[model samples]
Structures are given as structure tokens and as C-alpha cells.
Target: MSEFAFEVALCALLERERDEIIARQLGASVHGRRIMDIVCVEPGPDFAKRVAITPHEIPDAAIESRAGVGQARYYRNCFDMHPDRARSVAERAIEIGFFERVRQGSRLYVRQTARYPDEWFGKLVGIENKPDLAVPGDLELQLRKDVSLGVFDEVILATESYVTGAHLNRIPDEVGVWRFRPETGGLEVVREPTALDPAASGVDIVDEYAGRTDMRVATAAEKARLRRRMAERAYGKGWRSFDLPPCVHGAAKTVSGADGIPYCEWKESVVNPAEECGPACPGYEPADPPEIDIEAVRDRRTPWVANPKGPRTQSGLDRFL
Candidate 1:
């Protein structure tokens, strides 16, 4: 099976089996360029509070700002970033219902609609999908980076290849192994992962040369901030981030009870629309894309809310102010 198909199938299976928030293709690095294939966010004490605030991501800058729910503060005073950037973040926060703004004597003031929940998310699990382990591409180095950074509470490798003694020796001991068959929707945990300490400082591998490597120490505070960002992003951006192709053959296929998996009739299997679909293919025919309400599907299959009443209950005048 194609790696894209395998990823979608696994995500669907995980979403059906697990109660946590599931997102795919998220930035998991604090300072480096590492994109995790799948991220599972376990709910913390105030997960519901977060879900109530907004269906979209709350800007990190707004969360870090000094805005309070009790009183409105001058917008400029709340953020430490550049004036233009701060304004942009505040505007996004307001748009997302995380912040409510009012104008006072030509000065804009903003306050949190509700308090930002510090305990909105619990442990984060990162998964790396490599369907064909025989052609592993920097798999070891990637896993090593994840283990050293300790950004995720647990790191897991999911593959369809048959594991041998040689493969286990190359993989990090702390990283768990899972053999998944996409066609059968079968998953077997070959090894269990050891929990990593996300609260502690970690090493960020910056660059590597022939014999030497450059690294930076990421403070616990930085990791904490990254974790919050990850949680917010995962909550907002689920795995079904793709659109069905605008081709006659494009169709939505259900996998493990989760709808909206992009399937191609010409190929007779799940396909990545972005890469595989276009007029360049001989089987392609112009047509309107299938009408699939992906967000509704997500809402039906998961705890995520597609649309919720904003936390702000102020009069209509206040909303425009």
C-alpha cells in the first residue's frame, strides 16, 4: 500500500479506538525542522474548557500575553512582539473567540473570553510511519532526535514490514514498534515505549557534519511552550486535512468507521489527491469534487466540535467594539 493510504488507515483506526485528539503532519520540533506523521494528544484536566473556547487554534502569542479574563487591557501592552505582529495575533485571537476586544477612547483593548487552560492537554504521543522499512530513509536519525528531544511522552514507529533482529537492533530501545497491516486494519504492538520526561531540558540536534554535530539545549520552559502549541494545533487541525480530488474518479472511502478517506476509482485504492490527481494522469476526467463534509465527519467520529457557541456572552454591541 502507498504510504499515504497506510497513514490514513492508521489514523482512522487510532481515532476509532482512542479517546485522545488525533492529528497528522504536525510540527513537533522546538527549533529544528521535524514534522511528525501522527500525534495523539491525551486530554488533561481542562480539555473540555479548551473545546468550549474555540473550534480553531488559539494563537500562542495571545495565550502568552498578559490579557486577563477579569479586565480588558490595552492591546499594545499585552504582547511583547513587534507592534504589527502583536496586532495580527490579537486579531486572530479575537476572530477565534479566544479574545474579545473593545474600543476605549480610540485605543483598542482586549481580554481573554475565558482563562487559558494550562491543563488542557496531557501526554503527547508521536508516531512515525514508514510502510516499507527496507527502504528506510534517515529513520534511525529521526527516531534518535525524537528520543533525545523528549518532546513527546512516547515515540512509536509504525510500519508494515516484517521485523527481524537486525531491524530491532537499529531502532532506539525507548521507541516502541508497531506492525500494522493497512488492508486488514490490524495493529500489533511489537514493543512498548518508555515514557520520556517532557518537563525536563532536552537536546536539539541542529546540524550534523561528517564526524561532528551541532546541538542546542532546549530549556524545560521552551519545551513546555512547544507542547502547548502542539496541543492547540492538534485540537484544531485533525488528520483529514486533505480535499478529495476534483476528478470523476475521486470518491470518499470509509476506513474503520471513519469517513472521508480519499479514494481513487481508477487506482482502486486510497490515493493522495495532491500528488496523484490531476489532468496529467490518463484516467483523470474533469468533474466537481465530491461533496463531503469532512468537518462534520470529524465531529461525528471524534470529540472535536465543528461549531460551538463562543465563550463570550456579551451583548452584540460588545462583539463589534
Candidate 2:
């Protein structure tokens, strides 16, 4: 199976089996360019509170700003970033119902609709998918980076190849291994992962050369911020992030109870619409995209809420403006 197809199948299976929020191809590193294949965000005590806030991602800048629920602060004073960036962040926050804004004279003041939930998500499990382990491109290095960073609670490597001692020895001991079959939707744990300490400071491998390697130290606080940002993004952006192709043969295929998978009839399997479907293909025929309500499917199948009532009312300043 292609990596994209394998990833979608695994995500579908995981969504059906686990209650955690599943997201695909997310930036998981704090200061490095590490993109995780799949991320599983387990809900914490305040998961419901997060769901009540908004169905979209609350801007990290807005969340990190000085704005609070009890008192409104000068919009510009709330953020440490540039004035233009701050204004943009505040606008997004207000639009998403996470913040309420009011204009006083020519200045704008803002406050959180509700206090940001610190414990909205629990352990984050980062999964790396390499269906064919024979062509393991940067697999060992990526797993090493994840282990050293300790950003994820547990790191796992998922593949379709048969396990061998040589393959296991190449990766870190802390990392777990999973043999998954996309055809049968079967997952076998080859090696259990050791829990990493997210509260401790971590070392990020910045770059590597023939002789020397550059590195940066990430504080626990930094990791915490990244974790929050990642979880919020996962909550807003689920695994079904792809668009269905606008080809006659393209359709939404149901796999493991999760709908909205981009399946091509001509290919007779899951396909990466962005790369595979186009006028270049011989099977291509112009047609309206399939009417698949991905959001409704997510609402019905997952704990995520859609079009939820805002937790707080706006300040009613729009009418005056």
C-alpha cells in the first residue's frame, strides 16, 4: 500500500478502536522540522470544556496572550508580538468565540470568553508509518529525534514488514514497534514503548553533518507550550484532512466505520487525491465532487462537537461599530 493509503487506513482503524482525538501529518517537534505521521490525543478532565469553546483551532498567540476571562485588557498590550500580528490573532480569537472584543474610543480591548483549559488533553502518542520497512528513509533518525525530544508520551513505529532483530536493533530501545496489516486491519505490538518524561527538559537535534551535529536544549515549559499547541491543532484538525477528488471514479469509501476516505474506483483502493487524481490520469472525467459531509460524520462518530454553542456571549460591540 502507498504511504498515504496506509496512513488513512490506520487512522480509520484507530478512530474506531480508540476514543482519543486522531490527527495526521502534524508538526510535533518544538524547534525542529519533525512531522509526525499520526498523533493520538487522549482527552483529559477538561476535554468537554475545550469542545465547548470552538470547533476550530484557537490561535496559540491568543491563548498565550495576557487576555483573561475576568477582565479585558488592551488588545495591543495583551500580546508580546508585533501590533499587526497581535491584531490578527485577536481577530481570529474573537471570530472563533474564544475571545470577546469591544472598542473603546479608537482602541480595542479583549478578554477570553472562558479561561483556557490547561488539562484539555492527556498523553500524546506519536506514530511513524513506514509500510515498507525495506525503504526506511530517515526512519531511525526520526525515531531518535522523537525519543531525545521526549515531546510525545510514547513514540511508536508502525510498519507492514515482518519484524527482524536487525531492524529492531537499528532503532531506539524506548521506541515501540507495531506490525499493522492494512488489508486485514490487524495491529500487532512487536515492542512496547517506555513512557517518556514530558515534564523534563529535552534535547533537540537541530542538524547533522559528516562530523559535527548541532543541537538545542528545550525547556520543559517550551515542551508544554508545544504540547498544548499540538493538542489544540489535533482537536480542530482531524485525520480526514484530505479533499475528495472531483473525478467520476472518485468516491468516499467507508473503512473501519470512519467515512470520507478518498477512494478511486479506477484504482480500486484508497488514493491520494492531491497527487493521484487529475486530468493527467486516463480514468479522469470531470464531475462534481462527492457530497460527503465529513464534519457531520466526525460529529456522529467522535467525541468532537460541531457547531456548538459558544461558552460565552459576545460583548455586543459589533452593533455600535
Candidate 3:
């Protein structure tokens, strides 16, 4: 399979526990409304026909007049709903990137929140009525019409590593990628940089479980992660969720298995190692060995000839000189 071009981002999961916290307070689910396998399709042209995942809305009361899963949790942990809670779940949500806390004039402010940012976060393109905001939380989340959950759609691969190894070919302009998290959870945004960039932010998780991006590396590191992930697959247990190296062989150093035989060893000797390859391979980034000397090379009248014993000139008497 070839790499499919698609924009990518993330939407935080809503508290969708299937139980009630208090008899009076309850919680809501991000995917609560639809029981089907729904792939949230975004309204295009950047605006219009945007849909909201209605389940994120704050319900009037628990399903049975008690705090449902969401209501109880938020209230118990100090949700804005119950100003008398022991802790504030809303504050924690903002701290953990669940929602944003913006100031509204006076005490009456609008909520710019979403259960899953992708579920209900977007431009108000085609929304007919203003949804009621009853979920009492520090940050009030609102609904939108133009945008949708970011899945395999808004991703970008800066590094060619994914393209080189996989049978997948990524078509251009497929997914919209973002370098930073969105303010309103408008699109799916991850904390980690795409594997195409050498930046090492662990937040580089896939937009979803099935989605994946490369772990950007300096060839050797990439090889390492590839081997680790591949080992899981070779064992017939783990699914191949991450990207692999390119078509080049021998460029990767295959670690030996306990069987006394190496898997995929031929790929290394057959492929060319990149210049940035590390100790696992011959290539490496230039690191100053030591502040030995500009004067050492300049002062020496003759280059120290290489001897198996040590680096020195051939002349026995000249050694001191």
C-alpha cells in the first residue's frame, strides 16, 4: 500500500464513562449520540455544513435525575456546574488540554468547548440554532459547522522516511497538517512534531489508533525504532502501526535474534548508509573530538605517519622533536 496524502490533528476524548457519578450528576460521552461507526465528515470550502457531535453538550440532568457519569465527575472534582465541589474537574480539563478557559465580560461568558474538539469544534458555517450550554465547567465549549475531527485527513510527513520504506505512496494535498495545537480544538492537533521533522516530542501519537506517522530520525535512530516495531510484527503479534525505512538495503543495522541468525541482514549490506548514520553504521554527524590544536597540525613540520603501534613519525630520534 502507498502512503495516502491526508491532513492530520487530534481531538481530546470526552469523559464518556458509561455510568453515573452521583444520583444527581452524570457525565456525557463524546461519541454518545451515535451508536454507529461514524467518521465525522468535515464541511468543505473552509465553512458551511459543519456538524457538531451533540453528545458533548451538557445535558439538563442525569439520565435518571442523578448526576450522570459526566455530571457527577465534573461536580465531584469541582466542575463549574457545582461551585461547591471539592475539586474542579473543569480546571483540570483546561490544564490537561481538554478545553480553553477564556474570559467573558462580567460572569456571563460563552463556552468555546467541545467534548472531543473534532466532535463539535469548528467554524459556525451551517449551524441553524445556537446550542444550549448547560454543562457547568470553567470553560464553556461551543459548537461549529465547518470543521470536523482530524483523522487520516490532516497529516503531513516532513521526512521522506515513511515514503521510502512502505509500499504506500502518499498523494499530495490530502491531509491538512498542523505544527501546533489548535486554540478551540478546531482541528486534531498533537503535541508531538510529525516524524518528518527531527524534533523529538513524544506527543507524536497517531490521530487515531489505526493512523500513524514516522518517528523522524537521523537514519540510525529510525533504523532502531523500525527494528523494534518490526520485531513485534515478525513475531506475528503486533500490528505495523508506524512507518518503516525506505527501499534502501543494508542502510539499517539488523540486530541479531537469539536464533543465531539475523533477520533482514541482507538489506544492510545492499543499501547505502546515509551520511548522518550513527555508530551502528559508518556515517556520523561531526562532533569535535577534542580541542587538540590548530597549532598541532600547523606546528608539526611533518604529518604524524600512521603506525599500527601508535600515531607517530617513522624517525625514532624525531619522536622527541
Candidate 3 C-alpha RMSD relative to the actual structure: 26.9
Ranking by lDDT: 2, 1, 3
How displaced is residue 318 in candidate 2, in Å?
35
**TM-score between model 1 and native:** 0.95
Worst 10 residues of 2 by lDDT: 312-321
Clashes of each: 0, 0, 59
Model 2 ranges off by over 4 Å: 312-321
What TM-score against the true fold does each predicted structure earn? 0.95, 0.95, 0.16
lDDT of 2 by residue, 1-321 (tens): 899989998998999898889999999888888999999999887776777789999989988889999878899999998999999999999999999987788989999988888887999999999999999389988998999999999999999999999999999999999999988999999999999999999999877779987789999999999999899899899999998989999999897566998989998988898999998989999888889899999987777777776663223212211
Q: Write the per-residue lDDT of candidate 3 for residues 73-140, one digit (tens) a residue.
A: 32332223455322244444334333344444433112223332212111111111111122242111
Superposition error at 125 for model 1 (Å): 0.2
| C-alpha lDDT values of all predictions | 0.88, 0.89, 0.21
Supply the global lDDT for candidate 2. 0.89
lDDT string for model 1 (1-321, tens) is 888889999998999899878999999788787889999998877676777788898888899999999889999999997999989998999998999988899988999999998997889999999999999498988888899899999999999999888898998999999999988889999999999999999998766679998788889999999999999999999999887978999999886667988889998888899999998888999888889898898877877777766653222212112
Winner on lDDT between 1 and 2 is 2
Model 3 lDDT, full chain set: 0.21
User: What's the CA error at residue 99 for candidate 3, in Å?
Assistant: 5.2
